[model samples]
Target: MNYLKEYNELTAICPKTYIKYSEPMENHTFIQTGGIADIYIKPKHINDVQKIIRYAKMNEIPLTVLGFGTNVIIRDKGIRGIVMNLEYLNDITVNENEIIAGCGASIIDVSRTALKHSLSGLEFACGIPGSVGGALVMNAGAYGGEISYVLKNAKAITLSGDILVLNESEFEFGYRKSIFQKENYIILEATFQLINSDPAEIREKMDTFTALREEKQPLEYPSCGSVFKRPPNHFAGKLISDSGLQGTRVGGAEVSKKHAGFIVNVNHATSTDYLMLIQHVKETVKQNFDINLETEVKIIGEE
Candidate 1:
């Protein structure tokens, strides 16, 4: 494929935007194990985002949108066509008890910003390692707090270049889902409604959560945060740990002894190795407990 020519055409339309051809998905993903993306883009402005979408639509190119790559896995054959990463669009601002943040802004950073402003609602997000956009899409939460609880509204651009502002009710938030997953809308920004609190109290809560994450999770390795979603009345980690699947290895990928919920890349683990280990864990857990395990991580691209 003459990806350079396509890159040239894309560059012509989305001028000054950073674009690359045959970019390695491993470098962009948190797991660091995937093939190449045909074209990778980082748009600096919302205008560029609109232009890229229009170009991709007109050319019939497959467009894959990526956040900060914290909780996703890209397959070995990589993603074809254009992959847009909303990294440079990050910007955060605070107004009294409300926070207005770009979709690309780090959720962790946003939480910190809340603490700095003495906001209490985002303390649950203190340890989340995803973009605000991705967190909202999946309704990411921990320690009894979810994005849906604090979200006011969100700004999104449709595939047809139409802008829409959706309120909290329209999000359809659930355990780990929102309308964004089913709709072809590109999230632009989000507004959060928070409560004013003592900076000391917020910091104490943030510190506690951070300490707990470090103690319980395998923070010293490369892996998607948590591999499986919690079952109806059972915890995925407890099931895997009880099934004696900890420290199990598939190639360089291993189920972390520290947290059975996480599959870590202890060595040069490929996407295949990671995936195979996940399957093994699921099957073993299902066989032992008669419960099916669904993944929390978003797996994309080709096989």
Candidate 2:
């Protein structure tokens, strides 16, 4: 395929879209690791996203949707085709007791928006670092709250460029799983149902949660947050700590000594290092506890 020709066409479709050829994924991901993406785009408008999606489908080009890259690990060999980073789509607004956030809006920012509006329900997400899209994909939660508890509906685009509005019932939310994970749909925005609360009370809750995160989580280094899902009746971090896997290293990737759930990139780690360490953690935990740990973070791209 003539990538230059495709790039020019995409630019034409969305002249203001930030487009790059042979873009480095390492620069985009929070882990600061991964190989290159063939074509990278950060579309500024929702219309641009639709147009790009249609163009890719018409051209039979593969497209990958990306959020803030907080809970994902791209392989070292990198991804082929188009990688669309939705960061530029971030927009947050409040209406009555509801908040509408663009898919690319930071979950933390969304929670803050809730607070600004004196809205309750998103206090649990005050410290989550992923984008709204990522949170919806994983049904992300913390401190006794999850996305399913508050999400009313979401706007999305099909792979074929058709738009959709999925209500909460249609979300099919589970433990860190949502329909978006099973379907070829790109989340565009979300509406969250919340309740009016005292701003001071909401801020207090947010402060408490944020403080707990800082005290318990490893925030010093770059890492994909929480490598594995919570096993039934067991916490992944607790299990890893019990199995004595913390501080275990594969190259620069080490199971965080601070938080056993995280594998930190302490020394310019490659995706291979992260994956190997993850595999090691899973194997050791399975051997010791007979609990098969499933990864929570999304791993994509070639080997």
Candidate 3:
């Protein structure tokens, strides 16, 4: 694919935006793995995003949206076509009993904004190291709460460049799934309804959750967070631990000893190492427990 030609044409059409060719995906991902993106572009505004999507669709070029890169693994051969990053769209606002956040805004930043305004429901997302777009797409949750519980509505761009607003019901949010995933919608911003509470109380709850995550998770290393989704009536971690796969290494990647649910880069792990370790864990767990563990982390790009 001649991504350079597409990028050149795209730049000629939208010169105000930042565009790069053959940008390293390693720097964009939380795991610090992967190869390069054929074309990486950061749209400064919603209009810019719309134009890019329209252009990609019109030219039949593949387009991928990247958030904060918390819950995905890009392959070693990199991504093709255009990689649209929403990092520049980090705008947020808090009104009474509601919070509005752009796609690029960090979930932690949203949680902090909510806390500052004494909003209670967002306390669960205080430590989720993903962007609003990623959180909405996955219905991301933690500490017994989820985005579906608090989400009021979301604005998204359809594959054809038409903008649409979807309510909670329209989003069809389930555990680790949403309509955004099914329909290939690009999330723009989300509005969440939260309860009014005392700032001190909200901060205390967020602090507690943050502390617990730090104590339990292998946050010390680069990782794609939880590698597998929770199996029916059982946690993925317990399954891996029961299979004696804790601390198992494939190249520089290891099943985290601290949290068997996570596969962390203990050293300088490549994307290949991570993929191999993930496959090994899935196969081992399935053989031992007769449970086909599904990955919660999104794998993208090329091998």
What's the TM-score of each model vs. the native? 0.98, 0.97, 0.98
Q: Across residues 1-303, which tens digit of lDDT does each residue of candidate 2 receive?
A: 447788888878888889999898999888999998888999988888989999999999989999989999999999888999998888999899999999999999999988888899999999999999999999999999999999999999999889999996699889988898889679999999999999999999999998999998989999889999999899999999999998999999999999999999999999999999999999999999999999999999986
- Model 2 segments beyond 4 Å from truth? none
Candidate 1 regions with alpha-carbon error over 4 angstroms: none
Find the number of clashing residue pairs for candidate 1. 0
**Any runs in candidate 3 off by more than 4 Å, and if so which?**
none
- lDDT of model 2 at position 65: 94
lDDT of 3: 0.93
- Distance (Å) between predicted and true CA of 156, model 1? 0.8
> What is the Å distance of residue 244 in model 2 from its true position?
1.3
Model 3, residue 73: distance off in Å is 0.4
At residue 200, candidate 1 shows an lDDT of 97
Task: Give Cα distance to truth, residue 205, candidate 2, Å.
Answer: 0.9
Per-residue lDDT tens digits for candidate 3, residues 52-150, read 999999999989999988999999999999999998888999888999999999999999999888788999999999999999999999999999999
lDDT of 2: 0.92
Task: Kindly list the per-residue Cα lDDT of model 1 for residues 226-255, writing each as its tens digit.
Answer: 999999999999999999999999999999
Alpha-carbon shift of residue 294 in model 3 (angstroms): 0.3
**Model 3: how far residue 301 lies from native, Å:** 0.9
